[model samples]
Target: MTTTRSAADDARDLPAEPTAPWILVLAGGVVLLWLGVLAWQVAVLPERVPTHFAADGRADGWSSRNGALAFSALIPLLVVLPMPVLSRLVLWAPGQINAPNKQWWTATGPRLRRFERLMREDLWLITTVTLLLLVAGQVGIVLAARSGGDAMPTWILPVALVVFLVAIGAVMARMFIGGRYAAQPDLD
Candidate 1:
């Protein structure tokens, strides 16, 4: 005998995929990797530099400071690196709904639309922030070195500061444009 099912039965048959657990796992892994790298740097960096080697290790404080700044800049890159990974994981996972139903599309559509907008916004944001960090961090390292009586052949802090300011300005302009674009909700 053939059985006929109603719409309610069909919805009940549609499985809901859990996304939170995978998101949590991805976040936990990223955090743990960051902590591990930080711990390793703390534990082994001083040994290689040797505290007794120089006066307060000031012969080349720039290296340490620059390293610190570069490391800080890398944090953003590291955080963003997982986006593709998460996308892949979500794509590969079983029971994942590749497409949403009408209700979902109607309800969460705007949020998803905003998320897409933010993705475009982030490209400019990441470029600006990375460039700013690189310039400012180097300037900071140079200023620190010069302050510590370590004579560097070239003092480039002023130039670096200018570049940092320019990057900041560009970032502001891009953000303003993006905000304006996002304000007018276009149902495309």
Candidate 2:
């Protein structure tokens, strides 16, 4: 005997809605705010600024203010611009998506869509966090330059690294556990 399931049935069996509108809006807003801050700082920064900091948070390298500011602005641009485009590509082409159980998840429509949605949300979140961190670091550098002292708190990079690692680990765990992409038994 053989059995067939409708698309509706497959969707019903899949997890509930995975994307949240408010979260996406909030993430976008943060990136915009960071851009604004970068622009404002670039306008007001001195002729020379610290381009690098020592482990002790003291300025170790110097550059033209415009050059340093441009580098700072570039970090967020690199993260904010390509992320959404790549996320959309993944959504449209699930075959290109990478994950622990890529084959299993992309095998069925409902599962593939679900995985894509989750991955998109995760990418947005990672982009937001990364931009925020970069912005914070840039702000610290500017403030330190203005103050003529350390360009960052020595603890900032270490703490940020820990947070970044934790966030990535959590996202990966959620993808594997919540996605449940393993082969399922035949309904028939």
Candidate 3:
């Protein structure tokens, strides 16, 4: 009997990807939502007055100003509530929602591959910025505690150290993973 190659094998050799554009859309929506939330919070809030909430859980005259900020933040969060559904809607656009589990990979794998590429190209800059931000956050925490006559709790230092180590490990792992992906482009 003669052996025959299947469609799967043919697909493996093809350079085409089957992923839907849902991730791209979802990422855009999230960015827009984040920006809208930030804008409303900064633009609508009072300048310097500290609004007081009454002891009975009611807002006094000054506290009415606080609602503007809270509502600004909450409205965006509410608007973003449909993000997951929107993502699923995008996934379904290519009739992928009812397909088998293998089809799901067919959609997400290319996106993951691209992400690995981006990580490879930007790893050094990402790592540098992340490390600087982590260092700055630690400095801020220390300064905040010291200025208030409060010593950071005994456990906090160790916890912060652990978190910093874990973050560094994650960055290293991302770099290693990206390098591995770059080395084996066919596997993707």
Candidate 4:
């Protein structure tokens, strides 16, 4: 016997929870906070600031204070600004989202909603962590410069990159495995 399902039934099965507001707020707050820190630091920064660091964390290149400050401000903006927009796009147009089992997840309204929520949350978490690391690195650099130190720990950047990569890998693995195991709701 073939069973028939209506769009209403499918919609009813979808989770009702909207995107988590705290995630967006927290992500935005981090970006704003770091931007403020950058701006404040720039005011008191010396004439020349370290723009490049050697593997040992020693300053190898210098830029005008304005240039260094601009570069610092750009980092978080580059990393954090596009994430929410992309996340929203994923919700607005699931057909455009590229993922391993894309068709299966986007096959229904409920599945698509779930997928969008998962993707948005994942992006927010990743964006927040990355921004925090970047902000910390900038703060360290500025503090070192203020103290007349020519070197910041060389390991900061490498460690941050490794952590970021690992976090992304973990999130992707979780999504792929979860998607593989998720029960596909019958649409018939």
Candidate 5:
């Protein structure tokens, strides 16, 4: 009898990925919504808008409305848009993945699938949180522009920053834990 490699085994050889988890799709949707909000805000912005904020949350510098819009759009595009590309890169080049006990993970089909699922989920989580933070930033920009050098709501940025940091850290830690699972012999 000849043994044949199953489709799952062949999957490892393919450059294409399986269907994305819902969270990744959700992250993409959120970014699209953010672009919509930015466009609406740009349409309403005055000719001159505050583009920089001081340590105290008051506007310290100004720019033309177009300049402010360009700055805001450029940042999230740079920061958030690369996530899916990197995720695909990792899938295509699993050799780049580092773990304390990667041998066990790559040893079997089930373990490898589990390892990949965790990686994809963690990536989507990171992307979603980053999108949220960027959206918050754009909201602050619009509010500051409306306020005309007035102080922003004092607690908002600090609180949001801390929350986003904690959330991302937790997701990263979960990814590390996947290594632990990978190192184990399968009980199945």
Candidate 6:
């Protein structure tokens, strides 16, 4: 057999084995946990629950108990579920995904699968973090509702928000750096 571009011409290097996250398995559990917690809290919540909070953690906005419950439960699912779905879309339609090397990676099956696997894990990570954040907010809201005052602890949701944002950045950084491995796509 013969090849072009001398011996220097080699196929692209494949990426590292994808490390599947165990928490990914618990995604369903988290959603269920949120539902359970929301149900328990909503039962005890006043007719009006805090829908919005101020910098000082005061209840700045209000909504009906059912409204709060519906929004809280639905919003988290709406937000967290999409990323995983996008991951699947990336697998089905790699062309829609934006990576470092779009053409070479998607040009072959192995390369595209590897990219999709890594992306699936990355998106799952984001999804898991988002679920945890919403859980924290639910707990905080419950605590605020039970509090003797109209304000929460003034640190719970804010801290959770900051942590969630940081986590999102870290996952994105991992995608840009770790997901963008240098190994050639094919390694032929």
| Number of clashing pairs per prediction, in order | 0, 0, 0, 0, 0, 4
Off-target runs (Cα >4 Å) in candidate 1 are 1-111, 127-129, 135-150, 153-155, 177-182
Q: What is the C-alpha RMSD of each candidate to the true structure, in Å?
A: 12.5, 5.9, 15.2, 5.6, 4.4, 6.6
Residue 95 in model 2: shift from native, Å?
4.1
Which candidate number would show the highest TM-score if scored against the true structure? 6
Winner by lDDT: 6
Candidate 2, residues 1-188, lDDT tens digits: the string is 98895443454466555567976796879878787878878777889887688888888888888787778777667756567556545445555666677776666656655655666677777777677777767777777778767467777678877887887677667657775445545411
Global local distance difference test of model 2: 0.69
How high is the CA lDDT of each candidate model?
A: 0.41, 0.69, 0.40, 0.70, 0.69, 0.72
Can you give the TM-score per candidate against the true fold? 0.35, 0.72, 0.27, 0.71, 0.75, 0.77
Per-residue lDDT of 162 in model 4 = 85
Which residue runs does candidate 5 get wrong by more than 4 Å? 1-21, 108-114, 178-188
Of the pair 3 and 5, which is ahead by TM-score? Answer: 5
lDDT of 5 by residue, 6-114 (tens): 4347446644435456876787688787888788777887888866678899977888888878877887778766664564443445566685566655555555565
User: Candidate 5 lDDT (Cα, whole model)?
Assistant: 0.69
Could you give candidate 3's per-residue lDDT for residues 31-143 as a string of tens digits? 45455545544554443222322333222333233554554345434643332333333222433323223343334434333332333233333333333333333332333
> What would the per-residue lDDT of candidate 6 be over residues 29-94, giving only the tens digit for each residue?
777888888888767888878767888888888888888788777887677778765655655566
Tens-place lDDT per residue, model 1, 1-188, is 98974333333344432333543454455445545544544444421221111323244432463365446446546654434333322222313423223233223334333333333343434444444444343333344344445432233445555765786677566555545324334534
Q: In model 2, which runs have C-alpha deviations exceeding 4 angstroms?
A: 1-18, 91-96, 178-188
